[model samples]
Target: MNAIRIDIENVTVAYHGKVALHSASLQLQAGTICGLVGMNGAGKSTLFKAIMGFVQPAGGRILINGLPIRRVQKSSLVAYVPQSEEVDWNFPVSVHDVVMMGRYGYMNLLRIPRLSDQRAVREALERVEMWQMRDRQIGELSGGQKKRTFFARALAQQGKVLLLDEPFAGVDIKTEKMMIHLLMELRQTGHTILISTHDLASITTFCDQVVLINRTILAYGNTSEVFTAENLSRTFGGSVGDFSLATSQLAPGNQEEQEWT
Candidate 1:
């Protein structure tokens, strides 16, 4: 078993006087891939934000390898890939520029790219197969390409932990397979990966651990133990109906399947 890389201790986050995530906590170990499953507005993103220090928790604390986020950030211990919906794809930026942005944390105040930074950017883009289109406008790429571009940005950070939100949302099958393969490889290298996805099949397919959430964490543990029908039904509430425990699959209960699945 890998050592614990992420620790969340009874964290509570509120936005504009409304609590988003309350008393949420979990520990993620290095070299493991954990899935964050929840209904919409269930604080998956809030949990990610709290880990990245994007939001000040209303209560409790978070630690990376036992150090506070502030202390670990300087070491680039965590990297984030936000959901596509949160990005402005129309912004005038090239694929190479975006990937290079990840290296800014390691650069001087002027943010000029050094030889090492350039090498890191090139390697990241190449790893994601986006090097061929390094000069292309980010908005002009296909959905999968856009996703890969940002994924490359995260890779350029060379962080120990990777936080990806809805990575498979709009990607093609090929892209999905590629990402899964890459994530598995990263895990072998001792990178702890956290993914927030609506894809139920994927949770059982790849994640070693699963975190079920609905505003607060409902259950979290090894995939088979925590991803049972009972836990999923509770996490998704009235929306989740059928589950093949054998496969850890969840189907919606609504007359029509919810848009998320």
Candidate 2:
């Protein structure tokens, strides 16, 4: 069997006496992009938060590279990008400042950014093609630019795994292409990536695997085998399903309050 990069076994979560996910289990291999599809309230964002160590699981554990996730944080092995709206945009900060924050967790409390950290930030920004806007205030940039800026931040973390919530929700075609290219390059570097998205078309072409989730794991495996219309219908049986929402509506910057984690 292939080596597992992330292992979520029999994990369960709840909020205020209500359950979100029940006995969920999944194993993601290293160096592949995994797409998550599910209806709203299906525990998708909750799952990502669990992996980020933001929300504690009520049962079971999440592991990274055969080690507990709590231990994995020491290496900065996992990085997360919540939806754009989740960020407090009114906060005064520049694009460079945002990207540089990724390095803080790796640095000593009193340590200033070293030459290596600056170089890494620049390289990451360049890869996302956001270097030209490096000094620009993040609030002034367009929607796509903001996404790219955060993506560069994730790249700067140099984490072995990246978990993104709606990376392609809002953006022009050019920006979407750029994001896809960056993700592919990361895979080549042996990074494991997981994205929660509603774009079935891109999932067909860009992901190595597809995980169908709705309050529980419906299916997970090769994209070709798991993203069947039957599976989609099963995952989205009601009009309230998350699939019906346009990608435009799902953007982190555009969604309703408390939609992102």
Candidate 3:
């Protein structure tokens, strides 16, 4: 359970010659749900991109299961659920089609879905309770449904590592609960999950580990130890959302100063 699933060492990512993330490093263990918590433009997405092989780090190294991301991509060992805004809702595609796309790695040059691919897609949709809506247009679903459909796509890929970006951002409470439950189940099956989130209050609820980031990593480790008010305040540079710092760790005046929505 403690095996290192993702290894990042002294990584730095830049866009168009502008530094976005610098010297960020983290080692995520298998069978764990780690929360990547930070404020807006905190480079959480950039780090995820770097791990997914979307953007290469200008320096340092990132390894998934001791191999590079390119190899991982070829084996479908890592599945990604991007932020909602990153997708175009107007795209003409069905839920089933999107889920089947995950199996493309397993398909031949013509991209024909074999019997196993079809079965896997169906199983994935059922796992997310979206089988009934598989034929529905992807854009016609609710926010929660969209998230689930995409998550199902990831599952269909049979990846060992799952990187979900802002999964709880625009979903309802029911969707949030369902997603959390599914994630817990995956952890039990030895899947490593890294979730990038801005909702600080929810990090400790489900995460076994927490990473506090503001461009570079501020603090990271066991959630109970690293998700402290002091570290969080430092990460956010102030209070954010409906969060109140605990008095036992910080002075009352500091606590008051750190509490805000």
**Candidate with maximal TM-score:** 2
Best by lDDT: 1
Candidate 2 per-residue lDDT, tens place, 49-121, comes to 8888787889988988777778768776777887887788867899999999988877887858998899989
Tens-digit lDDT string for candidate 1 (178-228): 899899999999999999887787778899999998889999999989988
lDDT of each: 0.85, 0.82, 0.83
Clashes of each: 0, 2, 1
Runs of candidate 1 with Cα error greater than 4 angstroms are 1-4, 243-261
Model 3 Cα lDDT, one tens digit per residue, 1-261: 234389999999888787778999889889999998776677878888889888879999999778888876787888899877668887999999999999999999999999999999999999889999999998999999999999999999988889998888778888888899999999998899999865566678899999988889999899999987778778878753335442222211212212210
Candidates 2 and 3: which is better by lDDT? 3
lDDT, ranked from best to worst = 1, 3, 2
Which prediction has more favorable TM-score, 1 or 2? 2
- Looking at candidate 3, the ten consecutive residues that score lowest on lDDT are 252-261
